[model samples]
Target: MKQMTRRKWLRGMFAGGGVTLLAACGGQPSGETTEEAPAADDTAADAPGVVEETGSAVTVTYWGSFSGDLGEAEQAMVDAFNESQDEVVLNYEFQGSYEETAQTFAAALRADTIPDVVLLSDVWWFNFYLANAITALDDLAADAGINFADYQPVLLNEGVRQDTHYWIPFARSTPLFYYNKDIWSTAGLPDRAPETWEEFMEWTPQLIDGDRLAFAHPNSASYVAWLFQGVVWQFGGQYSTPEFGMTMLNENTVRAGQFYGDTTNTMEWAMLSADLNQDFIGGSVASMMASTGGLAGIQESAQFEVGVGFLPQEANFG
Candidate 1:
């Protein structure tokens, strides 16, 4: 597409209200396609400039997953886009977590009732693609003047399937190791992150006492499985092969599982937490593996010094 500053294109995306679907249905033949023109944002009907400048501005309905501080930030972005110009206004609606958003979207597909834009997590996008419910973004992106070259390859490439772009990266994140620096100092451990899981194990006894955890594990809904993916990779294992072959029964996978099992059920230094971030902030746990997306919020909320490090290595770093 045309060369433009990233800032301008980002403004262009939300200004149209549907970065993912606003310039949609590219490559798909016209006539009888499932895609539809974006409906206008009603909340902007009473806003100034919209009626005076353009009669009716383009409105892109968006569904997303974010609440509390994150949600407020998301709203700020939407508001900024709406106020940036009178040509378009983003109508963002919170649909709970990524999984919940996907679930509602699945239902919308069946009912033929859908939003113009959606925030799809990496894993959820593929499901919609497989169902033939989403369109390739190549043509639409071109029409929208998006510069694929500007995006990080690792971030941009994840959306490719059959040589076409079906998803785009926006809010991407990965697991980060968050530790309580006060706890670490009091335990007399080194200030830096542990070099390896073995080393962390050696230090765990020093951190834990009287039901306090050296580390805490999140529950499944908090994305325990996603967090565990890092550990699996650190142990030099994978959940599956590229072609979707199961690898959970493999030796390295088994070893990873065993190590996790031992942490909670055998070693007694870590335990599964109801809320990993809360537990860590409340001083119930010394460390945890949580999304980098949460780091800012954690830092704002925690009473103690919060330190982040690379996830301690196992057989290899994830």
Candidate 2:
């Protein structure tokens, strides 16, 4: 087995609000291999456009895909870091959406002009490892004396592949059950979110307004699979084995699919929507399962008081 490297690079970048790339380091873990060439040494010391000596501060570039208030927060962090230290200068850039950032990074990799630090999505970072587009941080972690065990086990494990850690949980999030408190009150339902699918189904009638949906199913390909995973687990089924090399097509999975179909197709309580959050905020939907990252935005946008809760589970499973 190949030894995995601790995600020290992530720790350093996150702490400093900047990142540095070490291109000469490369290693293959498990069955994967890559022949990618090293990126040119373009650190602040050698980069042409930057001043080599800014009061002896080391400049680092960070690329991210944050916008709106989130973008402002990131800029604020950069400002704080710059103000606190004279040894490091952090330059932050908003690189559009995650997909666009990935595309730009791929192009940069081919040209050997990649940014010192770039944000990669949870689903996409594994591909970067396969391509050897990034470096391991075992040595760096040891040099910095980072304690990997201090991080949350679940969140930290997401970064570990075959033992190697390639990504860290930054801006990590999960689906939340967001409900309109005013709508719930009008419906005469309980003040809290439903605890089970059956309970939610029971409350649907009261939640409905003439043409409004009680809930909206996420329709985008990106969200459907993620949300569906919760359903599959709730039904006591595994979508795939732990290794993800084989899929399971058992009765539980079938039942889970049937439940989703019933909600959207048969019962008419919920409809598939490309914009569930918008509908929920606009009063077209009484409730939705959405990213917790949007909680603040939803609170600011909604006219009614918002209530958040965990995703409802199957009664039997709960």
lDDT of 2 by residue, 143-220 (tens): 566555766677667666567554545666677788999999988888888899988999999988888889987774
- Judged by lDDT, which candidate is best? 1
The ten-residue window of minimal lDDT in model 2 covers 23-32
Clashing pairs in 1: none
Candidate 2: residue 64 Cα off by (Å): 0.5
What total of clashing residue pairs does each candidate reach?
Answer: 0, 0
Taken over the whole model, the C-alpha lDDT of each candidate is 0.69, 0.65
lDDT of 2 at 88: 62
Cα-based TM-score, every candidate = 0.80, 0.78
Off by over 4 Å in 1: 1-56
